[model samples]
Target: MDLSRPRCRLWRELVLVASLLACGIRQASSQIYITPDSLIGVERYSSSLAIENAPEDVQEYSWHRGANDTEENLIISYNATSHSRRDGPMYSGRESVSIRGTLRIWRSQLNDTGNYTVRVDTINDTQRATGWLEILELEIPQISVNTTSVVDGEDAVAATCYTNDSHVQWYVNHAPVSSNYRMTISPDNKTLIIRMFSRFDSPLQCGIEILPELIQKSDLVYVTVAYGPYSLQLRSSPTDFSGILSAEIGSQVEMECISYSRPESKYRWIHNGSLLSFSEKNITLPSLTWDQMGRYRCIAENSATQLTLYDEVHIQALWRRPVVSRSFTISGSLLVFLIIFTVLGFTHFLMVLIRALFRHYSTRANWSI
Candidate 1:
């Protein structure tokens, strides 16, 4: 307590300065140097923090997961002298360290993504390094169209490129797609909407672009256009356009129906005013007779467009009436003799009648001439 002892005061200051130097050295060595690059976790698994520095000077190794090193975030510690390791409660049986000081976490999920740091104590120095674990979204993506098929008109249709957490782009005919007034795409470039479609615009090729420079093409779904059966015509066996087909008695006549349609028209034959059982493009009448001479109609109908057309033809037989079947067995000579005798008898009767009239006239005296 006396001020006379100046040497004692100086000695006290020296001791305090030595203690400060030791503390400065310790603080400088404790400063950790972390790698600027961050680690990336891909898919459903992740990696853990492991001090890869295998220098013989490395006496101790430690790992932590926090902004600043603290007792709570201490994950694992290894002592080189004792050849022993201790794991904190956070990584109890799941965290492991290799003899070369590599930390690994097996079977990691999407949520196991964050910062990690390692503290190393070497023979010459003690320092720390920090890095990060980032899990990249690896969910598979999809591309879909709203309508499987459509009619060519002002109808609306849509397509979409889909993914869970990634951005995607759409392609048309192997090229990148663009949006316009009549056609629009969503802001995320996933949904494509079309207002109207043209006849030539059918079979639009749509696709999707995804990771690994891969492209997925779409199935062929062309828009359907509806039309009709046109240019309907009817032809007979002779293949002429006389409107009348001549057939010998008891002969066969074939008729063909010709037309064009989108989905092909079905043929139906009409005999007279009633429908026939035939439904082929061409028909045949097995036998032709005077009674069968009439008008035959060919009706062409499209099942898809519901368009129908009709044409008819008249059949004429060469014989006016069916040939009569005869059953006579008489000779020519007998037939001539009968004919002459009949004529002679008729002549004799006429002569007798005339003579009687003349005699009557003479009896009356006024007939003297």
Candidate 2:
């Protein structure tokens, strides 16, 4: 004898006995039975059992309350009867049964989330089947910010959170923030107000968590803050010049003046006594001419601080007018002619004197001989 084979046979026999017991209960009652008559907070409807088979003796079905079951809760109900089969030659005790019924669910609640069962009975047997009902509360509420932009020196800004449900919580950086005196939540329990000390560029996260479930978070929002201008200074390129400053006519000359500050400043170009429209890091004279030749200035204006800066530049004309005086020209010409005539006369006089002396010396020598 194999011990394993005997054990398997015993298990099968036990299963058959249980199935027969379940069927035999239906024979004990003539009616179909259901559980709890009412349901709450349930979104879907279902039953424990769909069909119940009973013997022919069953006529009417009545529902009975079981332990842990209540009235007004959803359940399954039905009615059924059995008929015997007869033949002309012989009559067998074999019977066939037919069942007719309707199923329905009652009032539901959020806490009614659980498993339910239906019991059916006949003259000889009773049977039961199990099912589940689920209730969900999904809702989102309104949220808003107290201030869109915060001041720099301020410790923190506040944002108000709201929701339709009673379960409301505040979150920042995906973590919950303390709802203390610094942060004031609404009395209705639908709003979660928070104040943060740090300045953040990314969006802040806030949300509400209901019991046994999580609701959607509030919309991500960006907070802006305003500050002041840090530093202000002038900058220029090739900042050296010399000589009889001269620049070509009808040519663009660049005069760059740059300023670095926390907040950028506006630039304006001033020529002589007039203000020009060119405002940039570098100011260029589109076309240079004699009329544009003068002192040029670059002024930077910071609207936030109401401050102005000045950078000076000299624009020299390419050509200078020739300076001439009538009196000086006439005097210079006369002086040159007078000097030439005096030198010629002085040379002729010296030659004549030398000749006369030579003739006198020759006559004296002949007389003494």
Candidate 3:
């Protein structure tokens, strides 16, 4: 054998050994970390902590209540071989560990706030990770109202927000509310008062900051505001009937009355100052006749506001000139037919008279001869 061949073989063996050592170093240097490094917990709620980059073939998992992984601080432990779990000295009834080395705390309370440590033991090695959780003294916010119904510009409405948090914010129609003559807020911003509640300030709400960037809102509170029978308007279906609608006789007409009111204004119709039989917002005239044409008025009233408003429309009857033109055409045709018949009858009479006279003369002549 040549000496150079042996040297090349020795160099190849050394390169293989270096590659194996690098892979072993990389595996040993891999770090284990915990998910949700920091979290906020609420009472009677659940929170979870999970491990990432943990060693595989984990045979045991141990969770501690504090950052230390001491035996006395162990909250819960799991045996991967038997797939069984045992409670430690610090184990609360709410703590559980998943097969993948995750810690879950149910019905978390204020005392649950602290650093948690998880130690995972695999067939080859062991690793540890820690995370912290904070518990907040918070609950769902609620709104209480003094009265649900109020008259516009005549009555006031008040609402109070109930929550454990003192920092509160008020909203109206989903928009932020501010202190003004019409509306006011309490010093703590918990109570909202409307001096003279209007329909615009409806659907009030309140909210509180539960966390640094999280806000919880209360349910909407609605106030029934009664106002206005104003802006009375009347329109016709054909749309041509307005202030002075000259409709042809026997044409159909539909009239609609509208107004701006909270409780929905009641409608009453009148024709030539006489109240119509129907009190509906809309009225239909199947056939427009002479008697139906006059000043039409719609009266809108609100029971809550005790206000009434009216809109009037003057409708004039048109003589349907097309029918008159048809009648004239028929009369002309009848006159022409009667004249032709009279001329034919006179000519027939003349012919009969001539024939009779001729027969009479012929007989006389014959006798005289």
Candidate 4:
């Protein structure tokens, strides 16, 4: 019985030495660390802060609101041994800690932006890890405008963006809107005003940055501007003619009028300074006569802008002439050759007949003698 007691004491000493060595190795090799040193949090959204490389002998996990692990800044603590959670003095109702020492915040607010610290308590040692979270407010922006339609160089328009986001940007036709003499933006970048609104300032939009890579844009706004009926152009179907159109009588001619204008320009045709009753953009003159030849006018008018412009083209009529072809000349030459050959052959045949008859009559007379 005395020998058994001594063996038991030696076994206990061996077990204690092994446990101490294990603890020393773990403390030296395994360093406690936190994932995502920096986190981006959105208002009214949920996110998490995770810790890695946790000590295997952890007894408790404490999450603090600030960079320090002091009792006053403690948020929530989880007891790894009992598998239970305890709320600290600084804990808000939205915060919770998981068994793996990860901190989760739901329905985050703007005040949640600050440093975060997590304390890991183990049987052998205590360690702390810190991180930073930046909270941003984001919302869908709405555009408000005084008027959606204006006259070029005659009216001014204003557009305002409504959103909870502090950072704002304005765009026109997908390009950034810069402040100039004709356009101005408010100091807060919420309102944009334009004096003498034109077509160049159309398709306006506003946007805000919700996160580092996420951007939210508002509905697009378009403005209608009445412009000019300038650059009057009159074109013909036979585009080869430059200033004047020379047409054969009974031929057809087509004329088209165009101008750069908003709401489309009304066109009229005039011939010899008289209205031709053509109100469309194009006109056709079929079977043109001598009277139709002269100066033709195309009048373009924009009622909204009260601007008028006209283009003119001269037309001359000429009698159609016949065209001789090589085939016709070749046929005439062949006919003349045939007539001359027939005449020569007939004359040769008559001379031979006369000679034969004279010879036969002489032989008959000699035989009779």
Please name the candidate that would achieve the greatest lDDT relative to the true structure: 4
Which scores higher on TM-score, 1 or 3?
A: 3
lDDT of 1 by residue, 1-369 (tens): 011211211110111110000011112333543322244443334354434334567787777776545668878878877889988755645566666666665555566567777777788887676666555444445556677454445467787655543345555444555787777878876677878753444554554332223333455445565445789989888554568777787888888998866567888888888888988988877887777788999999977566789999988765476688788777999989988888998888889999999888778867564
What TM-score do all the candidates reach, one by one? Answer: 0.38, 0.35, 0.60, 0.55
Best-fitting candidate, measured by TM-score?
A: 3
- Worst ten in a row by lDDT for model 1: 14-23
Candidate 3 TM-score, true structure as reference: 0.60
Model 4 misplacement above 4 A: 1-40, 43-51, 54-137, 212-214, 240-242, 319-369
Q: How do these models rank on lDDT, best leading? A: 4, 3, 1, 2
Which model, 2 or 4, shows the larger lDDT? Answer: 4
List ranges where model 2 is wrong by over 4 Å. 1-129, 149-156, 164-202, 211-215, 227-276, 279-282, 286-369
The lDDT for every candidate, in the order shown, is 0.62, 0.48, 0.77, 0.78
lDDT of 3 at 175: 96
lDDT of 3 by residue, 231-276 (tens): 8889885664438777778899888998999899988988998888
Model 1 off-target regions past 4 Å?
Answer: 1-202, 208-216, 222-227, 260-264, 318-369
Could you tell me which residue pairs clash in candidate 1?
A: 32-128, 34-130, 50-103
lDDT of 4 by residue, 219-336 (tens): 9999999888878888985552676887877899888898999979988888998998889988888888988989998899888888899988888865467886656345777888
Better of 1 and 2 by lDDT: 1
